[model samples]
Target: MSDERTAVRERAEAVLRRLAGDGARLRDDQWRAIEALVVDKRRVLCVQRTGWGKSAVYFVATALLRAGEPGGGTRSATEESAATGPAGAGPTVIVSPLLALMRNQVEAAARAGIRARTINSANLDEWDAITAEIHDGAVDVLLISPERLNNPEFRDTILPRLAATTGLLVVDEAHCVSDWGHDFRPDYRRLRTFLANLPAGTPVLATTATANARVTADVAEQLSTDASGRLGEDALVLRGPLDRESLRLAVLDLPNPTHRLGWLADHLDGLPGSGIIYTLTVAAAIETAEFLTARGYAVASYTGQAEDADRRAAEQDLLDNKIKALVATSALGMGFDKPDLGFVVHLGAPPSPIAYYQQVGRAGRAVEHADVLLLPGAEDEAIWRYFASLAFPPEDQVRRVLDALDPDRPMSTQALEPIVDLRRARLELMLKVLDVDGAVRRVRGGWVATGQPWVYDEARLRRVAEARTAEQRAMREYAATSTCRMRFLRECLDDPEATDCGRCDRCAGPWFEADVPAQALDAAGAFLGRPGVPVPVKKLWPTGLEAVGVPLKGRIPPAEQTLPGRAVGRLSDLGWGDRLRALLGPDAPDAEVPAELVGAVVEVLKDWAHGAEPWPRRPVGVVAVASRRRPRLVRSLAERIAAVGRLPLLGAVVPVGEEAAGGAWGNSAQRVRGLHGTLEIPSELAATVAELDGPVLLVDDLVDSGWTMAMAGRLLRQSGAPDVLPLALAVAG
Candidate 1:
């Protein structure tokens, strides 16, 4: 047995050398994890910091397991004989979280002479070939996204075979498997089903760098459970200290958004090396990237909204140090491995310290020194609340979804959106949760009711919500804490070995500049102050509108369509965002337009008049969309614009009944249904519009679904207006 163990160690060392270059040897913890997976065939959960060789452990284990080496004393004689057979062991199935991570893992696997393949959303065409490779024993490692586990075809067909034959299973970014985790993903819970179906004695590994004690234990418990709904013996958990000695952490409390932007622009060149600048919103990321580029910096904006090709190019640009920074959002948070990432600067603090740590861990992995700075914004809490609102819906909403689903017929999400009150993204997320709970099943077409009894775990969900609130509170404390920032983050992760790194701002004194150059500040202000976000016309009506008692389908008639509209700014913009949020927030009091906003509106109109896509004709009149919530604001805005433009003040379009009272919520179909036939052209307004020789300007406080504007525009065009131009104070994302 000792000789066999020695031989396994030697093979692991050789694999490490191939993966990490010559003279590379495994750390004791890395070797222990590899041994457990390759020799002992026991489950292991490794909670080590980023760049701590977590991938090395898995890749090395894959090489050994595929090579058909002898098993340890734990293996029975029959099992040992099976293990010693020719090298035809099943490939390692790694359930990774991100495409970027999978790409890195595949590259790393090749260095160890292990063939790796990926099946993700990006490569749908290649899944068949990859699966065939797995079946043919021509692949050593197969990476898949957790979301794929719930994919109907993959779940119904490929997953069962993979579970039965997988030699080893790895769950990367395993913290997402825990509801208590900062980055909880509903699809990750699907792994529980996969784990239960795995053949017994299949070694499993779950690795993450950000799991707290609660998350770590939760993941381990799930990973060790058996098929009979029974918890097995505890899995081997190896959690190392969370602290990164190479990181120097600090927080800069700038007075306002302009200053934050200015400071970044002024100091970006001084940051150690090519790195990432994180923003809370896509609008902010784009705005910052544009501002920096105008300032002569080589930077690119990266967001979930970016094209996949653009994101890939931006990532490669950063990897090759071709750009100074990639201004990004949480989309770039996990799975991006740049060993020498010099710094990570957060334009706004993430809602949890664990999430913040996970993002910052991307830096200082292979470098001697890396700077991590947090620029906490006053608007951060509002952004946090916006994201928190996306959590699992209340019990009533969940039941409404279940009630809408059919037992036999699978319904696509688009088909269900009109019947359900949730937005498409939120609705899909709820469906995933339901699918994981066995209340629904994703099939060929969409989702079908399982007819299986399921109870809403309200208490558990409430606890999770409370946990999120607590994390937000902790995040605030982290920003305000005078103690070592690194230590605070480590403690937030429940790292038992957390200590003052004696290098953070609190410990070593401030290492970053707080001053912003006046020139840079002015430039930031100018960039942000520039207004006029295009309110894209709803060219096509949402599908299945006819199912909701509406007769709409396919393309909206161009004759009845509103010309592309304009908003003074986006609600997510860094400059006007705060003021707009205050003015347009649900709880905000209805009032007349403020003078500053009036000035900005005038500027937008001026820019629109001469802009490339200028309106064909100036408005002949101004009409307001009647607002139940902000009547005063909407009426005042329309009257002011009419008075300023010297155009006739047309009366408002009035809501005929309670149907129009439906607030801006839910999917497009729901919004259009609630608005259809509910808005009436007042007799006086219709007469005025009929006499108009040019387009009528339709005014509102905000544009959310754009359905209201579309519906109102249709009404105006039918009432004899040549064209209807929609304008609003803000455009909600």
Candidate 2:
């Protein structure tokens, strides 16, 4: 090697040893990536397995770059900028995707003697100070979320400076940049613009352990661009075999969530160390955590819904071995680094094998042996379908968003919601997609049309959709395959060198019991069976409803609103979700309430009768919402409640037209319009309701928007019932 290359190599070694423990060293690929970044000054895409030290390459590169080239003397930050004619005037910038990932990265950076700061939604109060620190060159690494990249203040003013001044730009979890990526984020595409503005030869590095060959090529193409927006021919791609030998992989196809939870409860104590219990939904996470806690396991739920403080506390607890597990959703997926993590048990399969690989990669990082089990639930596909709906918007939705935007004036997402009836999250995602497509631009106020004619790539979207379907099928096949599960996943990732992992269950016989203990099963059944999630009364109307020509604005009057209600269970609940989903699923034949559901509601009302905040008054009568889809189901539930409580069953509140009844779509104001003065009591029903002396029960098959129950209850009250209560078989999540 040349003397200059040798010196750079020695410095990289020193940095790596510090970041890792004593006697630690880099693999050849790791050294190659560092060489490319610091010495060759080439953009590199590293696709290696977890625990392969992707972060080390960037941190060592940052140290080497910040310390100046191996030469006569280290240059000052400004002097280096002047000499190089570009690159960071300050620190390296990392576009992290998750809060948990950022926290872990910050700590890891600190151990390597690199001063790191994060600018994220959680630390808004500290952003100005952080910005100042970066400006003063006091920070070595700045980790910001992808969502933060598009912030008005950050994007318009601060990002260019940060981009131009960055010593090394790292896109961690780089798969998120590719639409074909399993966890694609629209915000990450903003890096295209961010990249275009960076100083030439800034040495960008994109790293991920999960990207397949296709995603690697896609992200590499993205990373190949320089500040001048010129795409290069080569992007120093470092792809490796993604096989974790330490993970003893297996799949447990339980009959349902109950059996899975029971198996977890029965076997958790047998697991070697503290680890994560993955769930499909937040409700499942919370439910699993609660059930495990009841079984004497020290566990907590970690999901997007968790408060930042609580999530931090939970993470620390697991790190400290203070908790046995954290039942979590994908919120805990990428960038969680725990070297000694001993196990990962998924309560349900992720949408795809690659996604499963990414999550299971969290375990067996530094251990000689770690158990990785996938508990494939019956409801896994349903959950997957629900999540798959959040992909890049269809052409019509995209066009709707663009049509709502005016190039002259920015419109906040809130203001555009009524104009275009998309939900907030979907709307934001659509806007981001449109922004990338050049149809609209997000500015200081909000988004504005760019007047750029954009074609909807229907073929491309169909390909993405098809790819997702293929992934789902692969996951199912993985569960059923007798071959090495690790090999199956590696092959799913399109690894050319995929081979049988001899340590996996298929290769070495089953490692876990197929049978859950009777005691554990009973316990799980009891926990799952005990149902009823409180349905908080909707009090306020959606904002901007009046400006959209709605008759009213602000809060709904107490007299018109129904009181806090009860549903047998949420459609997302692990225990009750399946039952509720079946009962309310589209094309589900509507009839009388099932006996089991009736029994569950009886228990709900029984528990309500004994609770501290019991019903304010005994229901004098029961009223069913006029149901076109499930008239029998609504009537049966009401009649059962009335018979059990010895209350009168007043006739249904029948509204005439579907236009007035409203389909299950639209925003709050539109729903109110559909329901407003639209519900009325027939003369016969009105006479019966008039004689009621107390609150009446309003029954429905489900409470999706809660508008049906709210309006129907108000009409019953107007008919002479003193107050109204809503009772639904299921509450849509």
Top-lDDT candidate index:
1
Backbone clashes for every candidate come to 0, 2
Clashes of 1: 0
- Candidate 2 lDDT by residue in tens digits, 664-689: 44455456666766677899988887
Query: 1-733, model 1: which lDDT tens digit per residue?
Result: 4888887887678778878989898998998898898888999999999989999999888877986854443544353323123554688999999877888888888877888999999999999999998888888899999999998899989999999999999999999999899998999999988889888789999999999888988999898788776899789999998889899999999998999999999999899988999999999999999999999999999999998889999999999999999999999999898999999999999999999999999999989999999999888998898888888888887887788889898889998877877788888999988888889999999889998999999899899999999999999999999898889999999998889899999999997879998999999999888889999988888887787788989998888899999999988889999899999998898899999999999888888788888998999889999988888989889988998899888888888878552345567878887888789998888888888899998999899888899999999998999999899999986
lDDT of 1 at 673: 78
Q: Indicate the TM-score of model 2.
A: 0.95
* TM values, all candidates: 0.97, 0.95
